[model samples]
Target: MNRNRAKWLTLMTLVLLTLTMSAQNKQKFKVVLDPGHGGKDTGTNHLKNVEKDIVLAVALEVGKILNKESDIEVFYTRSKDVFVPVKERSVMANEAKGNVFVSIHCNGVASSSPSGTETYVMGLSKNKSNLEVAKQENSVILMEDDYKTQYAGFNPSAPESIIGLMLIQEDYVQQSIDLASRVQDGFTYDLKRKNRGVKQGPFWVLHGAFMPSILIELGFVSNKEEGAYLSSSKGQKELAKSIAQGIISYKNAYYNNGIAHTETNVNEPQANTKSAVKGVTFKIQIAASSRVLALKPQNFKGLSNVTMEKGKKINKYFYSETSDYTEAKQRLAEAKAKGHSSSFIVAYKNGKQIPLEEALK
Candidate 1:
């Protein structure tokens, strides 16, 4: 009887300690690194340099740096020269409950004049250049068996096919944009590379990822000088270090219980004449651009109540405001009718933008 009681007490004590430890420890941030293209699918073959080999080397180097950080847990879709389906890559990230998914690739073009890095988040883009990039990347889906069945109605060559298929990632759009902006800053400022800026495009690899995801086009492999640098050991090391720094910065800002930092406009006046309102507000986001425009109705297609919010790298213009959700939807239609075709309704709690669904709830 004494022996049995002692055994039961020991088991209960271990269980209590496990529960306490689990409660005290926070979950580690998991990042999924995917190196694009491999095996028979040599991404872009420029003379002796191959895109697959370059990206793989960079991705491994990034993993090496991130692995030393105690707060982050890193996973690779493919650490070797093997091909993994795009859908499978996202699935692996999802299965791991990753916080972010980063797909790395090298850009190629017929002309070697364009030499810059661009990071992409999943969304339908109207820009012809953005569509072309999406098309080039989406064509990889064709290499998979039963891709037509797998992707359903998605046509790699048709930009219209991706219009209504981005609902799954809408909730994560802001988060993905935040990370992309950081990565672009690292490329431009830290590595002294030309920044092509963050863009939105229909990347199939990013669509299925449940968390914040981005596809990075490192640089143009067709440009001879850039290609030589990209294929070299020193360049790869620098690129990897820059990328790792960006990821670390983002993690510190987002997952360390810190507030998202915004840049302050130095020239703007700090005087507040109006009293702060205390309810949820909705606005129609008409445009987001790197350039700041004059805040006049004539500048934004006769939209009278145009307001601009400056972010770290871009300025967003919101047209009209309403406290009602239905009225906000109507305002979105109005903005779209006035040539702001990409306009959407955004919700704000107090002053900060909150998720539309959460605000509605």
Candidate 2:
């Protein structure tokens, strides 16, 4: 116990010193923007308009704006329409040491009446409708031939999908969710578009990211009105700019004290070192709930990480996931700095991932 305590203390000290050093050094922030579905992989084709083309235009425009305004370096998964695999997107961002990733897509639905803008982060969708959206976006992985192996075994029917999902950098989930919400909310409030609120679901493309990430569904192409708007270059530009502003908001919140980069202090004994197993203690409470089911992504996307369970028999909302409150505070701040809205607390019980509430007091 003494040795472990000493180790954790060393880690904490290192983290403090590193934070000071990072504040002193102004590293160029890096972001990865993925324009979803390219090449033969045309996404959401409707009314002679394609989701791929629309997102590409928006991404390029957003990149241009970001380059002009900030010293932050941004990279695209693909510069033009080409077959880039889903998992490769996160790999590219991580390899580049990207602080944040934004995926752009235009939504589609069988019903033309469904028109709205929504954004997404990685997690299992409790909503069947959200599951379907995830299915549409994730289906792209099948095109890659070895997606199952490449993406670390994304089995659709497994009860273990939750554990697998949590394995994708438990650190970044909160921030990603928040950033997605901000973008979706900003678009609806500023652009006066339909608000298809934020919902969680697993996407193969989002896994393996070391930083906060989000997938933006610009609008539904199946909806004639939305398809036309998304098809317009002006509309795409507007959408992209709004999303960029949301990222900027997340950055400002995180970097308020002048810290940068995602690396935890290696000098610290416990900082970034893997946590060990034990039952967790959760003083969980529902914090917020929508009076109406959030169909608008912006409405719900800005919400930080907490479990959302709306199973068949019950619907309980407004709960906090607190595996470790102290560490959660620090990580949450770090996440915001990395362009996420919030951060999450990932508790390890016996060296295995477990929900905070499941842990014993």
Q: Pick the candidate with the highest TM-score.
A: 1
- Give lDDT: candidate 2, residue 144: 79
Q: Provide the lowest-lDDT 10-residue window in model 2.
A: 261-270
Cα displacement (Å) at residue 308, model 2: 12
- Candidate 2: list runs displaced more than 4 Å: 1-24, 152-167, 256-258, 261-361
For candidate 1, lDDT tens digit of each residue in 1-361? 9999999999999999999777546467788999998877778877567999999999999999998987788999999999888789999999988988999999999897989999988877777888898888888888998898998967888767755556567657766776787898899998899889888888889989998899999998999999999999999999999889888866764564112222110111124411222377978777765557999989989888899998645568889888866566677778867877546666688788764544544
**Candidate 2 residues 199-302, lDDT tens each?**
66667677678888888888888888889999997898889889888877666544422344232211122455334323553222222222234433244444
- TM-score of candidate 2 to 2 decimals: 0.66
Candidate 1: deviation at residue 41, Å? 1.5
Candidate 1 regions with alpha-carbon error over 4 angstroms: 1-19, 22-26, 257-306, 310-361
Clashes of each: 0, 29
RMSD of each: 9.8, 13.1
